[model samples]
Target: MGQPPINSTGEARTIPVIEARGVDHYYEGQGGWNHALSNLNLTIPHEEFLCIVGPSGCGKSTFLKIVMGLLKPMRGQVLLEGKPIEGPGTDRGVVFQEPALFAWRTVIENVEFGLQMQKVPKAEARRRAQEVLDVVGLGHVTDLYPYQLSGGMRARVAVARAWALRSANLLLMDEPFAAIDAINRMALQDYLVDTWMKDRRTVIYITHDIDEAVYLGDRILLMRPSPGRIGRFFEVNAPRPRDRSSAEFAELKGLITEEMHRFSSENTSIQEDAA
Candidate 1:
C-alpha cells in the first residue's frame, strides 16, 4: 500500500496539486447560453483520490474535461501544479467509458502507441508498456488483439494503456467501470485501489454510484445540477479496505444518500419556483 495522505484536518497544511478557481462553462443554445458549471472552485491535494458525484447533467464529465484541458472553460482556470491548463498535456491520463482500444493493435502495442508518438525508442517503449500492463493485470494478454478480449479485459487494457504513459501524474477516470458487469466492476475497483496504493497517482473519478464514491474516494464531492456547482465535500474517515458489509460503511453511505436526496429536492423546488 502507498503512504497515507496528508490532507487530514489535523495534519500540517499541504499545497493543492490542482486548483479550480471560479470555473464556469457554457454552451450556445436556442434559448441562449446554457450554463453547465457555475463559478466552481475546488482544490485537490497531492496524492488524493477525489470522487465527483452528482445527478445527470450536473457537468461532472464537463468539469473533468476542463481539468483534462480537452475543453476550455468560458470563464475561469484549471491549474495543474500551479500552472494554468492550456490544453491536453502528458501530465494527465484519462480512461473513458469505452475501452477505445485499437482493433488492429496487440494489447501491449496499443499501450505503446502514445510513447511511440513522442518518439521514444521502440525498445524502451515496449519495456514501459509491458510494465504497466502487468500492473493492471493485462500483461499476460499482451499479444492478443482487442477483438480477442472480453469486455473487462479490454477495459484493463485501456487503463493499462493510460498508465503506461509515464509522464502522467494524475489519472482522470470518467465512469470507466460503467460498462462492466457487477463482479468485474468490483474487481476492477479493487485493482484500481491496489494500483493507486502502489503508485499513489492523484485520481479524479466521476461516477453516479454512491457506493462506489464512498468506497474509492478519500473525499467525495456532491454537486448540484442546473448549472452545476459544488454542494458538499464529505471526508471518508474509514480505514482502507473498507468493509461494505460493516455498519460504518452503511452509515456513511446512508448519510451521503440522504444529503443527495435533500440537495436534489431543493434544486427541483427552486426550478419550479422560477418557472
Candidate 2:
C-alpha cells in the first residue's frame, strides 16, 4: 500500500518522535574494536514510515537495537519522545525478522506479555490484547500457540503484540517480512500500510530489499557497508498504493539500483587498492 501524504508547509514542527544524533557504535572484541555504526544522524518524524537500507554487515540490526534501547551507542545519543533512552521500555516495541514468541504461551498470552510486566490489570490487558488482535486480523487465533500458526500468521501475532502496547510511539522493525513467502509478505505489507494509515504511528523499518523499502517508506535511507555510514537518502514521491510495474516505479528502482551498484563497486575498488 502507499504512504499517506506528508504535510509540506514546513511549519515549526514538534521534535521528532525518535532521533539518533552522531551515533557511533563499536563492539570491543578479542581482535579489536569493530565499528558497527559511524557518525550516524537520523530523525523519524511522528507518524512517518521510514526505511533504512544497506548492504549486508552495514549494522542495520545494530541501528535498530540502539533505537529500541537494546544497545547503547559508545559516542552518541538516542532519544525517544525527547528523552534519552537508557533501557528497554513499553514505549517502544520491536518486531524482529523471527517471531520471538514464547513457546508455552498462547497467542493472547503472548500479546499481553508487556502489559503483564508493567502490572496492568489482567482484565484490561486481555481486553486491549483482544482489540489489537482484531486489528491485525488474528482475533480467531488468540487461543492457538505460535507453533500452530503459519509463518505469516505468527508475524501477524507479533505485530498484534506490538500494537497492543499502544503507549509505544515508535515501532522498530528489522526485516520483519523477510522470512515469509512472497505472497504472504505482500499481504502483510498491505495490512501494515492500512494499519499505519489508521493509527499514524511512527515506524522505522530496516531491510535489504530495495523494492520493499521503496514501496513502503516515505523516505529511504541507504548506507554503505565498511564502517557503516549513510550514503544517500531518497524521498519517495510516488503516489499511494504504488504500482511496481509503472514507468516511474521502474525508473526509480533502476536509479536506486544503479546508485547501490556504484557504491558497492567503489567500495570494492577501495578495498582492492588497499590490499
Candidate 3:
C-alpha cells in the first residue's frame, strides 16, 4: 500500500503523535551561553514521516535530542502523547548516523539487545528479531558479526534492530544515511520507504540533503542556525514512489535550494554587519 494522501488542510490527517511547544535549548560555556534551539514549535502527526533540513551547525540534532529526552531544554516543553518527556523511553526508537553495533555480537544478537533489556522471553525475542531481519533483507547474515558485514549491511542491521522493537511509536533518525555511499544510500532509502509503508510508524528524520528530505518527508521543515529556529515549512505534494528525475521533483528541489542559498546569504550579511 502507498502512503496516506496529504489532506486538504495541508497537514497530515493523522492525530498529533508528538508535540513540541515553544521548545528552547541552551548550553552554558566558559565564555557565554550557546543557544542551540529557540522557540521551536512543531507537531508531528501519527504515522507521518517528517524530515528536518538545515545548514551545518543548525540544531537539527539538538532538536532530536530534546525530543528523545537526552537533553533537557532550557525553556519550553516537549510532549510525547500529551505527557512531558522526562528521559529516554522504549516508546521511542533512535537510529544514529553510525551503526553503533557491538563488534563481538552476531547480527541477530545485536538486534535482540533492546528486547533483552525489556526482559522479553529469549525465544520470543529471537523469533521477532528473525522476522525483522527478513524485513530488512538481512536474514542470511543474521549469524555474522558486525566486522564481517559490509557497510550497507551493517546499516541494515541497525535499522532492523530499531524496527524489531515494534512498540516504538516514534523513530528519530539523525542523518542515518549520510555516511553511506551513493548507491547504498539510495538502496537504503528505498528500503526505508518500503518498511515505513508497511509499519506506518511516525518518523522524524534529520538531514542536510534536500533530495533526501523531499523523497522521504510528508512535510519538510527548514531550520536556521546561530539560534536555531524554524525558517520555512514545505508540504511535499508529489505522489509516492516519487520519480526523482521527473519535472515536479526537480522543481521542488530547485525551490528548496534557492531558499537555502538565501538563508545562508542572509546569515553572512548579518555576521558582517555585527562585525
Q: Rank the candidates by TM-score, best first.
A: 3, 1, 2
Candidate 2 versus the native: TM-score?
0.92
- After superposition, the stretches of candidate 1 with alpha carbons farther than 4 Å from their true spots are 1-15
Question: Model 2: residues >4 Å from true position, as ranges?
Answer: 1-13, 28-31
Q: For residues 152-231, could you state the per-residue lDDT of candidate 3 as single tens digits? A: 99888888888888778889898988999988898999989888887778899999999999999988999988788998
> For model 1, how does the per-residue alpha-carbon lDDT over 70-176 read when each residue is reduced to its tens digit?
89999989889889998987778888879988999999999998898878899999999989888888878899989999999988888887787878878999999
- TM-score, each model? 0.92, 0.92, 0.93
Least accurate 10 contiguous residues by lDDT in model 1:
1-10
Candidate RMSDs in Å, in order, are 3.3, 3.2, 3.6
Off by over 4 Å in 3: 1-15, 29-31
